[model samples]
Target chain A: MENIALLMHGFAIAFSLENMAAAIFGAVAGLIIGAMPGLGGITGVSLLLPLTFGMNPTTAIIALAGLYYSTMYGGAFSAILLNIPGDSPAIVTSLDGYKLTQKGLPGKALNASTVSSFIGGTIGIIILTISGPLLAEAGLAFGAPELALLVLFALTSIGWLLGDDIPAGLLATAIGLMFATIGVDPALGQTRFSFGQINLLSGVSFIPLVVGFFGFSQVIDMIISGEDGAVATKVRIRDCVPTGKEIKMMLPVSIREGIIGTFVGVMPGAGATTSAFLSYIIEKRINKHRDEIGTGSMIGVAAPESSNNAAAAGAFAPLLTLGIPGGATTAVLLGGLMMWGLQPGPLLFTEQPDFVWSLIASMYIGNVICLILAFICIPILVRAISVSKKVLVPIIIAVCVIASYANSNAMFDVVLMLICGILGYLMKLADVPTTPMLLTFVLAPMLEQYVRQSFDMTRGNPSIFFRGGICWFFIVLILLVSFSPLIKNFYLKMKDKKAN
Target chain B: MGYVLPGLSVLMGLYWAVKAFGYRLWVLNGPGGGLFPLIAGILAIIFGVVMIMRRYRTKKKSDFSVKSIFPVVSVIGIIIASYIIGLIPSLGVFIIAWMVFYEKEPWLKSTAVGIGTALVFYLVFDLWLAVPLPMGLFELI
Candidate 1:
């Protein structure tokens, strides 16, 4: 009942003209960005973040959050029409979505994806609304030790699960940690590793690094890959309407996956891509039309699309509750929170109910807005997707440069952005995942502060970290995640030996 | 391509570890500025070495080409040009140059895009946001 009152208050705030405008703009931009083959939520948010600097924190966050989830909807456009996924999470959608297009049912595939995405997103938001404050309430009990261990678990899980190479991912995490140490140290206020440069004293700025890694590097990638001009498929709005039986088939699958994807998104490091893959696998195993899954069934289109959108919504719960990022995109959002001088976590809910609830309220609006815009603007969106990469590449580069410079108005940061962009591109070529690095860079200082505080409380006794159930739980999870690769390797070897 | 990043990581880890020792590792009972970096450095070195070894074992072929260097070099040129002309104009020139020379779009279209984008950025960043974008030699004049 109290929650209902708070939500109503939140709705009052979100209903403001400025906040509504922000949400609408974010939704439109997110859809266009998501439909672009190379851009995703992270790039969209990073590029637009600098523009929000002058706005109030509540409005700024609403806009960014709107963009974040709507990208999940927009990502399906290219996947269904062009047989090319707009982002990683949409890769599974392309499997059946493209098949449907080949069968001249592109409109059906798109409708299934859109409806499921709406259902899944709504379900995920409902779960978040119920669970977010509870998680924050639970977080209030966490002391320095528990917080430190929890951060360590988040970092380790991301490093372990992100890519094929565990060592590479761990190396990225270590590099992020090393970078975090460059500015003033949290423990003693002593600056280390600044290399005597004035700009280094404040540490590497988050905006420039993020823009470079996600934005500028993408520019380089586009140039290298060379643009394949606009997608050729066209869809009329009337053809997009689904039949009653088709809706019936999609509704149950979407509801089930929506629940499952929310849980997956709540877990640290398991993001929309994981949720999409997991839901698709389950759909393949259990659905009556399982054999038609990869062969262009509506259930196939519905399953992953709904789950990924749900997962995108689910990611916000931890971010809002604990200040820990749920994935790479949320990590960028976390940095945005800090940039606005707003510290996230339990205190945010208690101290800034307007900000928390308003942001939450805006998600419901954003979800509906995304569905309406997606349905009404399918023709315009297809035209936008066909915009030549020749035009997009240079424009994106310009945006990246200006955004980086706008953060601190320092030419030095621009130079830093260029350097990071090159390094990020090189890292990509080496097949080293950059997401772990970005996540760690955002979280490392928090981890360091927590660890230092714990040590201070215990007078250097490390046993303080193992004192509570929460600490032990995180410790066990961290250890298991860290050794998971080795366990998998051993199991594979044993299976091979047994077969022989 | 594969070895380069891990190899750089090894060097960076060594440098960080060595520099970290100069800062006090411990301050009274708790850690000081250097402790976290020292640990991170050591872990980086260990992981970097393992990455190198794994790469060696797999021996993946490199997909890198000189074409990848074009964007990096072009951006460097833009930065240098920003100091001479100004950031907005340099970016304008970058767009025109990129579209004309590289993408081979029509001169009129490239110029229009270049000028139009620069005008929008100036309005948004300078006029609205009020970021003190560098004027470079233009400021002196």
Candidate 2:
């Protein structure tokens, strides 16, 4: 009942003119940004984040959070029309979505995707509303050891889950952790790795690093690859709506996939791309049209689209409740939160219930707006996919420059952004997973502080980590996640032997 | 490129580790500032060395191309110019040059793009947001 009342109050706040405008603007921008090939939710959010500065904290987050989810809706446009994924999560959508378009059912494919995306997003938000506070309550009981363990668990799990190459993932994480240690020690107040630069005292700013990693690096990729416009497709708005028969067939499948995606999304390290693929695989096995999944089937378009949107929502639970980003986009959102001087954890729920709930309320409103806007603007968005690289690259660089410099009014940050951009390009070329690195960079300082705090409480005995059940649970989970690939290989060997 | 990147990480890690070891490793009944960095450096060294060794064992194809370096060079050029001539003017120069020389767009269209982008930046950041942009030589504008 209290939750209901608070949520109602949140809606009232979210309904304000400024907040509503922010949400609608974010939805429109996110769709346009997400529909652009090579620009994903993370890049879009990082590049546009500067616009939210100097705004109310609630309004800023509402806009960003809206962008975060609406991008899932926007990504479908290019994935279906051009056979080019707008983002990583949309890769699966392009598989069957394009095939459907090729079969002259572009309308059906687009309709399925948009509807599924909306249902999935809506379902994910509902689950987030119920589970977010519960998780926060659990987090509120955590101590220093628990926090340390949880951060460790997140880092290890992300490293294990995100990339195919485990060593590269760990290496990336180690580098990020090293970078996190570059400033004045949070505990001891001693400068460690500044190398005698005055700006180094405060540590590497998140904006420049993020903008470089997700934003500028793509510009380099586009330049290097000489990639150009996506293939164009035509579809009338009147024909984009699914037939009643198609809708009836899709409703249950989308809901099931959406729920599955929500659960997968709630799990740390299982991101939207994974959820979409998992839903596709599960739908392939269970649906009556299993054989027809990849061959222009409606189930193909509906399941993954819904699942990815749900996973995006599910991702917010860990970020909001535990202060750990569920994926790369949420990691950027976490940075935005920090930039606004807001920390997202259990205290965010208690100390700023209005902000938390309003952001949630905006998600509900934003996703609906995203659906309507995406539906109405499909023609424009499809044409938008063909934006020439020559034009887009220069504009992107200009934005990167403004975004880097505008935040702190510092030229030093622009230089830092360039350096990080080079590093990001190199890392990309090396096939090293960047997400683990980014998450580690964000979480490392918090982990170090917690570990030091726990040690202080225990008089330097490491056994303190083992005493708490929650701490032990996380430690064991980390061990399992880190070694799971090896464990899985071993299990496969055993199963093979048994079969022989 | 693969070996050089990881090799650089190794060298950096060793340097950081050596420098951090000189600090108090433990203080105030807890792990000191140096401890985490020291740990991170050690991890970096170990993994970075492994990456380099693997590079030697497996021959990976280089994706680096000479054409790609041009964009990077141009971006660096723009950055240097911006520092000397302010951001908006530098951006105009970059946009015009990139479009006309590299992309081979018409000089007229390229100039339009250049001026249009500068105007948008000026209006958004300078006029509306009231951010004090560095005008450099273009301060008179």
Q: Name the best candidate (by TM-score).
A: 2
- Model 1, position B106: C-alpha lDDT score: 100
**After superposition, candidate 1 runs with Cα above 4 Å error:** A1-136, A159-163, A225-363, A370-382, A429-431, A486-500, B1-3, B47-61, B137-141
Q: Candidate 2: which stretches are off by over 4 Å? A: A1-136, A161-164, A229-367, A370-382, A428-431, B59-61
Model 2: per-residue lDDT, tens digit, B7-92? 77798789878877766688888888888888888988998988877777888855776765665676677778876798888888
Q: Estimated TM-score per prediction?
A: 0.68, 0.69
Q: Note the clash tally of each candidate.
A: 0, 0
Residue-level lDDT of model 1, residues A396-488, one tens digit each, is 778777766776778788788887787788788777766667667766886888889999998999999999898899899889877977898
**Candidate 2 residue-wise lDDT, A1-500, digit = tens:** 66777788999999999999999988987887676544568866886688888899899988888888888888877668655466767767876887786665676787899999999999988888877756434435566787678667655656433435778878888888888998988567888888788877889877677667666776787677765533223445566568898899899989999998887676555578767876776686578877788778888999999999999888888788789886778888899899999888878878989998998899899999988987787655444434566776777777677767765677788788788778877887776656566667777887888888888898889998998677778788888877877899999999999999
Clashing pairs in 1: none
Each candidate's interface RMSD: 2.3, 2.5
Worst 10 residues of 2 chain B by lDDT: B61-70
Q: Label model 1 with its docking quality class.
A: medium
